[model samples]
Target: MKTIKNLFTALLLVLFLSAIIIACKKATDDPQPTPTPVTSITSIDPSTAPVGSTIAITGTNFNTNPASNTITIGGVTATIVSATATRLVVVVPTGAANGPVSVTAGGQTAQSAASFTVAIPSVKPVKEVRGTTFANQNWKKDTVYLIRGMVYIPADYTLTIDPGTVIKGAGPELDPTGQNISGTLVIERRGKIIAKGTAAQPIVFTSAKAVGQRAAGDWGGLVLIGKAAINRPASTSFAGGVRGVVETYSEFDDNSGTLQYVRIEFGGTSQPNAPTNKLNGLTLYGVGYNTTIDHVQVSYSSNDAFGWFGGTVNAKNLVAYRGFDDDWSSDWGYVGKVQFGVALRDPAVGNPAGSNGIESQNFDPGENADGPLAKQNGLPQTAPIFANISNFAFSSTPTVGLYQAGIFLSRNTAISLYNSLFYGYPEGLHLDGTATGTLANITSGALDLKGIVLANTLTPVVGTGVITNDLATAYFAGAGRTNLIVQTSDLASLLFNGANFTLTAPNFLPQAGSPLLTGAATGGKVADSFFTSVSYRGAFGTDNWISSWTNFNPQSTDYDR
Candidate 1:
């Protein structure tokens, strides 16, 4: 019996050993699981970087060995500085252009979802511009021009500025004659400035200070002098001219070349010779109708954004932003036609001499009185026509200070405004001075305001001096006049993005159901061929024209490379 038990035990041990051998053979014959190669580029830091710059690329399943990982930027092989399972630091290769970045690792290749832009090496050379130009000069876009002191384009000379050109004006400097020689550009009489730019690339004139250190009045502004009729005496010199004549003969259609899609920022410094005579952002002295002025933006001006001193230059699509003085000021004789203009004021900035959206005067207080009633009935009157204007004095309620009327007419001015929107001003319209002949002009249809909408104004109309407030009110609310007055609450329904008064970003476009979209009066002065016939009351209808090119936050723009 003991021998039989021993045999059973041996059989059991043999069966167990046979079972172990069979399992081992099956495991050896069957296929084993292999790790899945997961090599994928997740992201690239600084999608745009210059050559020789180090960039970190994040990915998945990358080789930990730096040499084992291969990276190419814009088809050029990059040197890997460090590597890990999920990240790789690589130096941008030479000859790398703007293209996709690829990585080859773990026997797999992966490309970035977005193209990597290899920034071109910036070698912005600075050119100091001073004195006058004797011959025709061309300013290229690749160089930065530092306007030091007063720079002038003499008579018969032409200054052509390429598109995307950057011209910076230096800070206030003292001349040998003790005059403040701020950086300024002056086009003499018969001289021309062909600075035409496209919507995608506008010519920029900004302060020379570094970013975030710029402010208004950092430099002088643009001055264009021409020969046109004026209300002042023929022999009276204006500005810095020895005589009033810019040309031998007065030509109404004298050409001053073109100024399109141009931006003037941080300009309008006060003149040292005349402290009260501050330089305007764009000063037109006797300019004529042949000058092409369109899509011009003036921002952060210490004086008037646009000042016309005896000029007949027609303009369109003008923008005046955050100006301390009058947004549009006209004196002497300005018989120009202006259309599609906007003035957006900043509540924090204002002129102590009083700020107005439109300030029109036939002549200064003590000038242009050559004969009897000459100040009131000059040879060439200030009878400019402005249409489709949107003048917002302030985005919101402003502190009571120097804010004045939306339209201020005095000194026998005969300016006309039509199809316009004026809001957020202390007074909507004011006719100052009794003997200014403004009341008579309005009665005779010389000084007219039609199809106007006034909102959020403390005083709708005011008449001082000879004109009576009751008469002004009667004229504004009289028959055949399509003027309407609304409150700030009602303005919300009239504007699509009305509350877009953010300092850095603003939206002046009308909403879908806005009243400004239709009911525009295209008759009278607006029917002229110079004005575009649009069925909109304000500067904008459906599209925001100032969106693409204009810079609202110019203080932060880095001009230097």
Candidate 2:
């Protein structure tokens, strides 16, 4: 009986304990203590941003503790304005580049749930056109300019002309006796002049008259002054032949000027009686070696095209055409190198009835004892005349296309003509100076008749040298025409197949079978990628900026581009 009573009592106690244990478990499982609910991430404005633009942010989620939780924009903290659970505003840092924004609460970081992007602006085209004037008397810089009767560049001022800029001259036609805008340009005081131009848009210094109506000797030509080594005869005086009486100055490496792709037309002779009044395209009085000249064309000048008084500046890609007197005339102390020159005669025009392709020398041999044509002023003693004259065809008429040049190296001017084609002239190449001469100078010796072709159309002139048998045979072949025919497909392959020629303008392309398409020899220091084809020559190759020969006329009003 005692054992039963004890068991019952133990059961009751066990039941009570079980109930208590169940209640305790239920209380523990009720609900996780509500978190303090720290308001951190507020609100972000302008989810997107532009490069260099400001961004705004607002929110109270930023920590309110000392030093506050970091609210960064593009990794940089923003200027925290009002801070609250629902309001936190900050101006976007200016230097904050483009990226994401982060907000940190306590130690936890809330990744930029909102993303932003940078924007780009658009491009516009040129619409304004204005002319420059020299009316203001502001001569702080050592420069010169001219718009009308006003002179911006004084005789001693250095001038800088940007490429593709057109400068027009006004006033009388060559007669400088009357007060007009025809005064000579004197680059005294070692002043520098920079005229930079490109192949497509050459810097043109021309007269105000229309191109067709414009006459030679219209405006004064470019003049450069410098001090450097020059090539002159032992007996000749420095300033004997030139017509102008320019002031004297000396400067070596006159970091003054640069000229490229410049075209000066309808200049040369002026004041028929006054020789000093004539205009030469580019006249260098005492230019130094620091100046540069390339891809320059002086056409339809009344007198000589180019004349160097004294200097050592190299020139290349020079074309002189339709001049009344000599094409490339150099004399007084000129000691520079000229390469890739093309002196073409206008079959329609003639100079004093008869003249040759090129007329140059260390002295003005034809005019006086120091003239380029004089025997004493011939090559070997004069400055070294290194030129690459090729693919030239003179006029067929004796008055125009006589056996003059093809190649004329008179007065022993140390010159070398290689891989050149001369046609129509009675003489192929003339070496008449009292100096040593050689046939090896003609580059046709090494290659079979494939490179240079000289066709003598007129009766052979006695003084000019004879063409080599190989060159004559190779050029004439069977028809006697030395013209090289380039196919259209071949030109396209070279220009368009690769990145050789980029067609920036609308209609620039070489005509099929054009002579200008022949390629220059490989070894020469000619421009490698000037033309698209391996056979194209001259300034332009093939693109899409020019019209067909039949459709395009020089008299047309439409511009090329």
Candidate 3:
């Protein structure tokens, strides 16, 4: 009886302990916490941008994955560049309307307080423009501008010119007798330009004078100066407090700007009868490799249509039409790359001091041609590579000044011209002056003009002592196969414009049965991905690259207000 009574008391004690433990557990337990969603945009940077431009959007509660986030500009779907919890990068969509920019992420949406403005294509009336320093601003495609003075875009700023934007220079007439005070757009060092125009609507720079009165040197043309490698005289960088003049850049590729599908007409000013103080349709000074310049055309330029001074920029699809001087000039140690270009010369427009499709030299006439030698101070000795070019002297009665040629290489220039065509020039390829160093490169296979075709040239090759016309022709002929000196009639189907070389409606493509169609090499220095390899010896292949985006008729369009 005593054992049973003790067991019952123990059981009751155990039950009471169990009940207290259960109550304590229930009191200590807490509920799971939930986070609130955030849906707000604090701010936006560069609230305005054109189509196909990048813009940064900042806000809260953005998904980490860019694919999970949705962004729209002006109600159009924008391309997401990157995404994070606090920031997002997107490109303004094409054909986007003007409206609020919105973002939707993780089932939450946020709209910016300020609406994004759509860049409208507004046309401007003709008037005078230029002579002021341009700030860092976006020049929209809304209206055309008349540049009357020397307009400067200083460093730390960008001048964004939209496609279809017409900029006319009002110099000479705007400020007559003041040559230095021309309507010019100068991009100083550290400044950048992003003018990517399309073929259908290209960016045009022309004279402000009426069509009937317009002439070359009406005003200064587009000049781009950058901090890139150049072989200038020692210790001559940014001297004289000049804003645009730069000495050199350490890098091969410097990100300065882009100029694509652009046309400059009636530009290039000079003194009464000298090549001094002249400008080009497009001038690149110490430009870097990072710059993108292609699909450009210059017409009626008094000097070189496109000139380069000490830079490593690469260009393609260039057209120099009816220029008075050299179509393409390189000096001051320009070691860039050029391919697929066309130069059509009109006898009515030219000079007597030796005009050529290409004029290459290591330095200016006064500077040391071999000083610092080649590749000194990170500057190559005016060694340029020209491939797949078409140079046509349209004038049947070619009056060459100072021995004109399809190409002129002098002053110790180590050049490579391949897969090209030269027609109607006084001399197909002329190498003048003292160039002992450059000649060695030819024998060493470092400098050469292979697979070239010279049609109707009075003299195919001209060079210094030992490299006379006969020696040049023999050396070039023995160097490789596919080099030819043919008659103009043998080329077949190369139509001409009005009197000569106007090329109003040119068909540069050779006939199917022509030997030039199959004489091109498949591999070479220019056989990279950036360049399209063709089986033809000229600039044109099956592709019509010069169509649509280029402007051949600058005289008909009235760009002034």
Candidate 4:
């Protein structure tokens, strides 16, 4: 019996050993579960969805979380709702045009076979907006609007316009006396306009008339009211507002708003109530130092392109293209800094009264010698500072009614201009005023000119009713002004695609070895905390900032398209 038990045990051991061998063979042959095949999309339910609607997208191998997946429709990023391996939900965005929906997940992408049909919202029309109040509302990018009548934005409101918005002003119906009325945009005191446009997508404010019929003064233009120090707190002209009296706050840093990369075209419409003209392309009324205005272009304005009425706001990269009247004008207590400015006078049209490149004043509208409208404290005067300015008046003979020069400084205006180029004018600089005007200011070191170039001017410098022409010319020809060149040539090679006053793609940058390419005065004289330090003069460097951005043909381009 013992021999029989041993034989049975040995048989059991053999069977166990054979089972182990079979298990080891199977373990060695086992395969890994295939990695979740790269995330992919199969289809999107409800292939069409309107803006702000939710969409359900079904896909395969998508990540379990929304952060791992991204979806876009019509190039507009959609707000993610939920994401799973087999499905994703998203909300369509505004300003999304009709286009295919695309899904990307974990290094894998998939697109819908057909485009998602997106219905565009009907365009809204704005007319005769005399009163409208806002509380931090955003004007979207997708809306193109037409404004009619006098649109006013009152105090304590914020109007944040998106990039690439095109706002058109339709001319008003004919009033009595056979004059075509104008539609105006007025930003009243304490109203803020936050229009920060991009270089690629600039905000355009223009006339709504057809291209061929469009002319200057189709609209009343932009009006801004801020609270800053002003010598004359109120304006004599009622159309723009009471000038010499402070309309807004008195804080120097009171933030009015931001205006960047904005183009105001075919503006300067006259108000029915005011003097001959009140608001120009852009009128800053008592704007404070905290207001920001840069990269602004005023094209084909009937009156002044940029006018400052008693404010301390600063500006940079200003372009006045083919304007009929003065390019830059200052009145009241406008204590501002302007850097990198360019003015091109219209060869065809010119204001008979004056079509100066720059005209400055201090309250005394009547060009007399009474001196500045003296303030109670005599504080915060009309002393505007300028640098890197280029004024090009292309016409040899004045236009039909033009009586203008490169610059006219009068009426107790205290100003300083440095590193500038003035050409194509009958007279370069004309300084005049009452007893406390330019003569007194210059003696007091409040009004001065340095590092200037005057070319093709019949008279380089003239002191009106004060110093003689020779004395004025000698004053500008003093030390540190050796690079100032005065010649008759238009300096054709220095500018690209520019001729006359209405040419396109104007490049103001000088060519290699040109005198304007170097020798700009630095330090506290021309230097200020408000401006970027640039060694070159004339509103440009080797790199052209206005090349890809500016629009020379606003009359032809349709804003809605």
| Native-to-model Cα distance after best TM-score fit, residue 148 in candidate 4, in Å | 2.4
Q: Write the per-residue lDDT of candidate 4 for residues 76-95, one digit (tens) a residue.
A: 78888998788999898877
Off by over 4 Å in 3: 1-123, 126-129, 132-134, 175-180, 234-244, 271-275, 366-375, 395-397, 401-403, 433-435, 488-502
| Number of colliding residue pairs in each model | 2, 41, 15, 12
Report, for every candidate in turn, its global Cα lDDT versus the true structure.
0.83, 0.48, 0.74, 0.75
Residue 269 miss distance in model 3 (angstroms)? 0.7
Instruction: List TM-scores for all candidates, in order.
Output: 0.79, 0.51, 0.72, 0.73
Error of 3 at 480 (Å): 1.8
**lDDT of each residue in 68-169, candidate 3, tens digit only:** 999888778988989889999988888888888899997988899899886643346553445545576566555667775567777788888888888888
Q: Tell me the spans in candidate 1 whose CA falls farther than 4 Å from its real position.
A: 1-47, 50-121, 174-179, 240-249, 366-378
Model 4 residue 282 CA deviation (Å) reads 0.4
TM-score of model 3 (CA atoms): 0.72
Report the C-alpha lDDT of model 1 over 208-281, residue by residue, as the tens digit.
98889988988888988887666666555545311234333367787888999999999998766556667888
Distance from true location, Cα of 135 in model 1, Å? 0.7
Off by over 4 Å in 2: 1-156, 171-183, 199-201, 231-256, 366-380, 384-403, 435-452, 459-561
TM-score pick, better of 2 and 4: 4
Q: Which candidate gets the maximum TM-score versus the true structure?
A: 1
How would you encode candidate 2's per-residue C-alpha lDDT over 1-561 as one tens digit per residue? 999999999999999999999999999989978665454444457666543345555544455552575667777676665555555556565456456777776566765556645444332221111122222222211122222321323344556665555554443443223434453343443455667766665666555455356666665555555655444444433221223343333344554467787777665535324445455767675566677877776766667678776566677667665556556665554556666665555544555534455554444434433322333212222343433443233422333332254445444344322334444455544444331322232233211122333443343322433444444334334242233322222333323223112212122233665454564444443232321224544333453222221111112221211
Q: Model 3: how large is the Cα RMSD against the reference?
A: 17.0
Score candidate 2 by TM-score against the native.
0.51
Q: Which number leads on lDDT? A: 1
